[model samples]
Target: MTAAAAATADGAAAAARARTAGGGAGPAGAAAAAAASADDDPFLAVAVPPLPRQLSAKVQHAIISADSQLSERLSEQLGLPRPLILELMRFGAVHYCPVMPKAGPNTPMTPEQLAAASAARAGAMARWGPAPKLQVPRRAMEDAPATAGGYARVHLQPKRFPAAHTTDWRRRVLHQGPDCVVVDKPPGVQVSPTVDNVLESVPACTAAALGLPLDSLAGLHRLDAGTSGVVVLGRGGLAFARWWCGLLEARSGGGGSGGGGSSKSGGKSGGGSESGGGSESGGGSESGGRSGGRGPKAGNEAATARAAEAARAVEAAAEAAAATGGAPLRKVYRAATLSPPPLGRMVHHALVGTRRPGEPAHTLMLAVPVEGSAYCELEVVQVKPIALTGAAAEEFGPSAFESDIRLVTGRTHQIRAQLAASGCIVIGDLLYEAVSARAAHEAAAGERAAHEAAASGRGGGGGGADAAASSAAAGDGGGGTAGGEAGAAAAAAASAEAATAAAEAKCGFAVGSAATAWSRAAQADPLRAIGLQAHRLAVYDPERRLGDGAPAAADLGPGWVEFEAGVPWWRA
Candidate 1:
């Protein structure tokens, strides 16, 4: 049977078991039973479906009956591309439990035991020592003569996240300058690559679509994965890129926007956006998020000072920049708020360090989560009504008004967290609202729905979230991680919970955790396009000085340019 078919069969069996356990109750009872079963048997959640075009790839898992060449086995059995499989392994997507998961009429775990087991699993995973390479050799328990990390029936799961994939991201290109590629990014797509799936991101796809090398494009500013709008990417090999970077960094030094920074070169930041928790997803981690870069510690004067100093160090280079061709950039975003925002510039400082005793008079501070830091606060510069139409009109619901927000800095989950904290959550952002980054198993519900319809000849249906994953239109996921030894030996012997070590916890966790079911689901979810869009990027010539009043960008004089990626998800 096709992987999809196998998943269907497995789901049927689970649903049937659920019905039996519930004494043949109603559909709701069956559903609850199925969920209970899923906790015991993860396979009920692993459904292989047809890959959608411009959508993300599905999450997958496999059971290892024996041990052989790891990558070869996955590539051959799952029908996934070998190179892609290799990439998954490198990013820690491919995971394994030496022993089989416990399945078949097991006692249901209580919430306490479940929580404890969950913690244990996470701990084991953390110290879970790096996984083996593609060509590593191994033996099952029966084949081992003791004293080895012996395994008979092992459990394995290799997941690929969902990423918005389009061969023509080039067509979406808003502007292609000498050293910058600005594009109207689509919703549900990451601005740049995340730790798990690098190939499906905005920069990577944009580079592929533009016939440029992968590393050629880099982000100067970021948009949330769910937000759709204008993104400025620096073509690092060119002079313009360096100058722009310097300009951005200098602005960071001089306290965000007050005109523009001199165009120069050399600004440090990138590889990925900042990572951390917020009012959205609180975490159980030491750092609160998966960010590898340093962020200001909320209101920590020393940390924020350190951040400012670093930017100042880059200022000299930027100060030397010609104020003309390399000018400062102005950003504007359009969002549908839960309620009308007070009109005017709203200045938010670091949650603690907005102003310090004996601090300089002209000093400016930012909100927590600086550099995606959970500690700092975000500065939402301006919020005003939009000339509404379409989705924006419908989303406003005759109460709240959608607004155009001018930003001082763009960071991950910044808009959602800030807006939600300000008393208006984005229409669909589960991360900051009741749904915490959204549950990973929610996809399992969708999978079960699809399976039922398919079994009943309804052919499959749609309407659900997907992840950020897969380069190919048709990614292979055939015989499962393929059963190596005898089928009976691998028959749900391992605890299904073993397969789920951790979730890419939406509880404020930024792209870091993988191998867990929720991570795949969260990343794959296109529904995550949380009602925010980067509306415009205005590039002003530093040479054109702004007088007492900051005039309209068009009035900023010659050489100044602005790009607007019509927000299709909201108002135009």
Candidate 2:
């Protein structure tokens, strides 16, 4: 064959091999062509099975009431995600009337029957002066037991409380007297029994501690289950009444007069009122000898009479003060908070209840910074009760601040609600900004990581990096001990371990302990876990005289008393 013909054949053969290797003309080519065809025509592709969307009980009810489109719109308006709304419907969180055509014999009308009856009554409303009587539909769970009315009813499960044995109430006594006892109450214990709880109340625990009957003891003031603080309880009804009267008088700005008078009289009248008359007589005798004696004697009589009248007036005032229960009482508290309020700002915010215009609530705060804490920036605030007045409620924002709170009004959840309205939610307060602190913690953790990273390394960016490195080096150098930085870390770990041990001991729970029986209790009740720092540091009654020339123990009055609890170990 000619050379040109051979070259042409070789080129054609090379082209054929290249086409086969590149998957241009074989099984590979066919597969590629098929994939291309599937891509171009979606129907040719293998179908991806759609996921089954689960609907909750609420979502199911919503869907029953409206179409999917309407449900979606409702969810949007309610600020709920579509998936959550559907899930709620599927779970039957929402209630609806079960499908029924007629009322059963000897039973009330079913929800459907009631609806029909209502419609009929409405149609005949023009003929009658009053609308026809119709049964209202009873709400029920999707999977509830059927009742006599031929409709199901959902009985809500009652909440369970932690067993009394789970809490250790010993060693919480702050002070005890014949009239009253002050207890350093721990968190999670109720001040009084409610419908859902009968045990683990402050009154019950105090009565048990004092070996008195529950009926014999009465609480003077209430502290929330979440708040750890000093609780005062009277030993009997008389004691309670006296203490309550004193507290009311103090709140009403009618204390201190009796105490002040008694103090002044005791200080000045040591030798009796006759000493002043004698002094006047002696001075007149020196001025005019025996002639002036009778004149001075008559003057002394008049002066003595005036003095006696003044003494009688003071005595009457004192008696009136005691009778009216004008015993001065003051409450001091220590709070740990997130925001650092001005050193001495008196917050006068009005708090309203469920059905009335709010009363004025006043709190005097003194903020102090907490040093060297990695958990969160905290301030130690000293709170003193000021005054509560009948005032209109004030508006406030929803931000959170952590502070030690003291209640002047001693109203229900006064500190919690007031502080929340003022935009300072206590840490771990679920009713307020529970999620806020957690979010802040996460953000702080990230910042701390960055800070540590910056501190450990040498200069890389600006003066800030150099300064951080220098500071870290200084800290390392300051550790001067054998382990240096390692020693500091070890110390920190040991401190943390000690704190954990103390917490475990205080809480009466240990790792893997049988406390799990009551573990579900706190989880069932969110209020049990909220962190409210309201420690009653001290309480004072002005009518209770102390120090030199004060009355003996046997001479003390019913409302005259004082009690104090030390700072919490965490703060100490």
**Which tens-of-lDDT digit does each residue in 31-80 have in candidate 1?**
55445543353332221210221222234544442345555555556765
Name the runs in model 2 displaced over 4 angstroms.
Answer: 1-163, 252-327, 354-412, 421-423, 434-524, 529-531, 537-561, 566-572
TM-score of 2: 0.35
* C-alpha lDDT of candidate 2 relative to the true structure: 0.35
The local distance difference test score of model 1 is 0.43
User: Clashes in candidate 2: how many?
Assistant: 30
